[model samples]
Target: MAGTGRAGVWAVGSAAVAVGLIVALAVRERTAAPTDARPLVVYAAASLRPAFTRIATEYEAETGQRVELRFGASEEMLTRVRLPSAVDPGDLFAPADESYVTSADKLGLVAESRPVARMRAVLLLAPGRMPPTAWGDLASRDMRVSLANEAAAIGRLTRQRLIATGLWRELEPRVRGAATVTDSANAAKLGAVDAAIVWDAVARQYPDQRTAELPELTGIEAEVRVAVLRQSARPADAERFLRFVLDPEHGLRHFRDLGFRVVE
Candidate 1:
């Protein structure tokens, strides 16, 4: 009887030890760092590269998630997102203007959009050139003016402003078009053109160049917008990233630091 009781106690002790070990292992596994962190893909306008890159870095550090960024002109990015392809589409699309987001939403490409920042078209002047005070000055025959190609958001805004002010027909002949806003700004910086119509942020990039506010461009600010794509495999992650970007302390601060105007 005594031997049997001792054997039963040993058995019980062994079983308890085994159960404790199993529970400990389970807890450790639960607390262990995740091995498979899915990456979030983002398609953004080229003009947003600097600020977005910084925000991506900060997000990755804080969330332990990865970010893949694709940068191009806003219209070009939109076209890429709309392309029918076998490969997976990006998780998010951030365009330089709100119209692109609205078009994407209409096409069922975007699930939702939020305005993140704002910018305005301005005249960037070559070194030693006097700033133009009015829209009519851009139509001067002697002035060699650089303008963004129609594909860029800045280009569309510039054309709209010119048309609204009745200067498009008169200034169209003097305009030299470039592929991107950066190129247009560079044309002025390199003295290839007397002036360029570019975003205020782009003009800020070349401190040596001068920026002039065209009275006609008033109230024509570009509203930068970010959207979660309908085809995104990870919509939650995309929304999280969008929230991070719109966060006043995190992403908007980066935008402001990079000379971008954050939308209030």
Candidate 2:
């Protein structure tokens, strides 16, 4: 019994020392001879999460680079860029709406900002639920609908457009009385609510939940954008990433798969 106990202690100590050495070596490698290429940093809108992730992976595999993606509301991304070091200025900034893209661009945070993908507004239905074919259907007295707050997004823009055509004024009572506001359109994509007004990219991104197309005549359309952050350490790499995204063969197909419209 004593011999067995001594062997176990010795083996454990040996294993611990081996692990510590391996860790130290890895740290040394990271510090001493890190790659000259800057790590690809990206701050993006939540709606772009699905598509951007795919692009990021592809870019890394092709170039042997590392990518770090930050997902947040459009407003939060803007605020973080201006305020301080909470978020490292990544190689790229991708926003969910044109308004946000323009806002951040004007702040002088990026070398250039452009619409990478266009997303229409969409109506989301709960799991195993049927989507409304028209905006008026959302006004059904029994239907409990929701919309994300317009402060961080253009949902308010959508609402106003609807009202201008009188589509929303009739629905205003319905929206006010029942439509709950969330911080993001992605939240409305969840199945908990009966119906939600969300970005088209979100609707198409999560097909398992269920979505039916609203008529194209519906008064809402929005564009999603990308910008190269000025503070990024890898401007050339960032430009390469952007060029890869504009590549017709891969980038177009990738965006199309995520339900985005590639504008010429």
Candidate 3:
């Protein structure tokens, strides 16, 4: 009877130890870093693709975090941010101009925003084409000019410049509209149009493209801005990525290399 009682006692002790071990393993598994973490999603302006791509590559190398990029016109990107659902929520938004960021902020879509770089509009001419001396030159009947559509940030800026210089009405009839600033640049590159009003950085992107300064548009700069979205499921990671992009040696360097001026 004594031997049977001792065996029963030992059995109970072994079972408790096994249960404790199983509980500890379960807890550790729950707390451990996921082996396949979801990539951070970034929604950026089309014009920023080159710089952002390089920056994202560097960021992934440094942090071992994957980055998924979605590029489009700034206005379109803003619209996406305003309508994020569970299936399509984004982590960050980097628009071509500050006005869009401000608009997003006003709508409670942006948690925080920081200025990243600056760009100015310029006239991009096709190979062997003479640079236009002024905006009026683009209004010539012989000139085929492309401008971004009204829904794009660059489009709004270009229209505002034309209106402020009293050239919108005259130029409107002659101008063809592209969906984005990059598209405007491509129009000139592909000879679909003789020239385009595009951001300076985009003009530099194509070696065959020549730039003509628009003096009337002087001092009119687009302030590139990045913002953390209120809809981000991982705000900490998003903020960290934002800081990485703003770092002088990391993302800002790429922007500078791409012909963007640092916003002071």
Best-fitting candidate, scored by lDDT: 3
Q: How close is candidate 3 to the true structure, as a TM-score?
A: 0.79
Ranking by lDDT: 3, 1, 2
Best by TM-score: 1
lDDT tens readout by residue for model 2, 89-207? 56788877778767867888778766677666666666766767665666663566566655645467767777677666565554422222233334444545576667666666566
User: What TM-score against the true fold does each predicted structure earn?
Assistant: 0.80, 0.74, 0.79
**Candidate 2, residue 226: lDDT:** 78
lDDT of 2 at 114: 64
| 1 versus 3: better TM-score goes to | 1
Q: Write the per-residue lDDT of candidate 1 for residues 1-264, one digit (tens) a residue.
A: 366798888888999999999999988976653437647889988878998899999999999898988898777888988983546578999987787898889899988888877788888999999997676666553788898877677788778877987878888888999988889888898899999888787788888878898777676677888899988888988999999999999999998898888875
Prediction 2 TM-score vs. true = 0.74
lDDT of 3 by residue, 167-259 (tens): 788877778899778888888999888888887877889887788887876755678899999999999999999999999988899998888
Scored against the true structure, residue 132 in model 1 reaches a CA lDDT of 76
* For model 2, the run of ten residues with the poorest summed lDDT: 176-185
Which is better, 1 or 3, measured by lDDT?
Answer: 3
Ranking by TM-score: 1, 3, 2
What residue runs in model 2 are displaced by over 4 Å at the alpha carbon? 1-37, 84-88, 133-135, 176-191, 215-217
